[model samples]
Target: MNLAERLRRALDAPAPEDLLAGDLIEGASVTDGIVPAAVLVAITRRAEPGVLLTVRREHLRTHAGQVAFPGGRIDPEDQHAAAAALREAEEEIGLPASAVTLWGSADPYRTVTGYEVTPVLGAVDPDLPLSPHEAEVADWFEAPLAFLLDPANQRAIEAEFRGRMRTYYQIDWEGRRIWGATAAMLVNLSRRLNAWS
Candidate 1:
């Protein structure tokens, strides 16, 4: 089976009991009126697949200058999580929705920032051209899936936040540091895929 098919099957299966990043954040679930959001985990179809990621513009109000998947809050007009993800991808990276074939969605994640995010898994044409949105994205790049899935590449970093120590996972690619919600989602994906391997 193809990568997309394999992932779809795993993602569609029952949720596993693996610990999530949000669980580590103190009072992460105490937020009221959480908002709905979605992100596209767009993987390229190549001999060695890579995942597309973007760096947010430094001036953004939330998660500024952070590396993330192409996605945002679901709009009222969006049909569902997948539709929202596709729209966000096109708006952020100029990647046409036609260039992607969505498999399925992984488990929804609740962020400490009060956004419930659904990760839409999809495979895109490896050669599709991408033009980052200057207003939202600082730049865009791809990381090899094999490297991302390896547990050895995952690092734990901690610092005092709001007078309490908090830990998070990160994966260093070249000079890019992928951490926070982005890294957490990738960890979840890795667990799902690895369970089926």
Candidate 2:
């Protein structure tokens, strides 16, 4: 089967137990209302597929200079999570919504920042030219799908957040650190796909 079909099938299956992960996994608590957000997990169509990611501009107030998927809070006009993801991708990276073939969405991940993010999986052409939104995206690159999905590459690390010891996942690629909610979502995706395999 093609990559899209395989991914869709895997995502469609019942998610394995403990599949949901985020800041809460590390003993963080959120007393505020959960904000709805969506991210595009854009898998490239190539001999060796890659996942497109972005490094936010340093000027951003929150999560500045961090590696992240192209996405943001779901706007009221958005019909669904998929639409929000596509819209965010277009606004953040200049990747047209039409360029992505929607597969489906994985389980939602709750961030310590109070965002309940839905990861929208999609397939896109690897060769498509992209223009990064200078205001939000400092840089953009594609990390190999194999590397991101591999269990061994997902590292568990600890640090003190808000004066409490916390553990989270991190994936280092070429020099970039993909961690936090992004890393957790990738780990969740790997689990779902591996479960099907």
Candidate 3:
């Protein structure tokens, strides 16, 4: 299927309730219960389809050394989730305005870290040049969307976030370890796509 077709199918399917892993992002100095943040889990159009993922520079202040969708806390100037997601994607990955076309958004998710995150699914041109800002990103990887959504590749792992053990899915791609909130968000996206398709 084409990128648009894949996204169309995903959006058309029935969506599941947003899964909560019990206060996932708690230690950060922010209030709980849904503060606005946005992330772009963008799929690209190419001969071989892929999803864009980023590795944070170990020097960053938050969520450092982890794989993530390019995103951040919502700004007062931001109008909506899609806008924020696109803007952050551009700021973080150097993806241009012409490259991304917004699709539907998934449910709002909360991290134990005090962010009520809006997960955006978008389609982008794979030809765009990408550069991870020196202080923000250490690397970028594009994994095939099919590889990520396949149930065969999914693994359940247990971890303690707030003195509570929770089951989370992990995507171990090549040498990269993709887990935590990014994995959580992808879990929701996979379900949404499954339902939509």
Q: What is the TM-score of each candidate against the true structure?
A: 0.93, 0.95, 0.87
lDDT of 2 by residue, 107-173 (tens): 9998888899999999999878999998999999999988998889999898988878878899999
**Number of the top lDDT candidate:** 2
Clashes of 3: 9
Error of 1 at 98 (Å): 1.3
lDDT of 3 by residue, 11-102 (tens): 65666665543335334344545568999978887776788999999888778899998998888899888888888888898987568877
* Candidate 1 runs further than 4 Å off: 1-5, 21-24
For candidate 2, what is the TM-score? 0.95
lDDT (0-100) at residue 165 of candidate 2? 83
Of 1 and 2, which scores higher on TM-score?
2
Write the residue-wise lDDT of candidate 1 on 77-151 in tens digits.
Answer: 999999999999999999999888888888777777778899999999886779999999999999998788787
lDDT accuracy of residue 179 in candidate 1? 93
* Least accurate 10 contiguous residues by lDDT in model 1: 21-30
Q: What is the alpha-carbon lDDT for the whole of candidate 3? A: 0.77
Which stretches in model 2 have alpha-carbon errors above 4 Å? 1-5, 25-27
Clash count (model 1, backbone only) = 0
Residue clash pairs of candidate 1: none
Who is ahead in lDDT, 1 or 3?
1
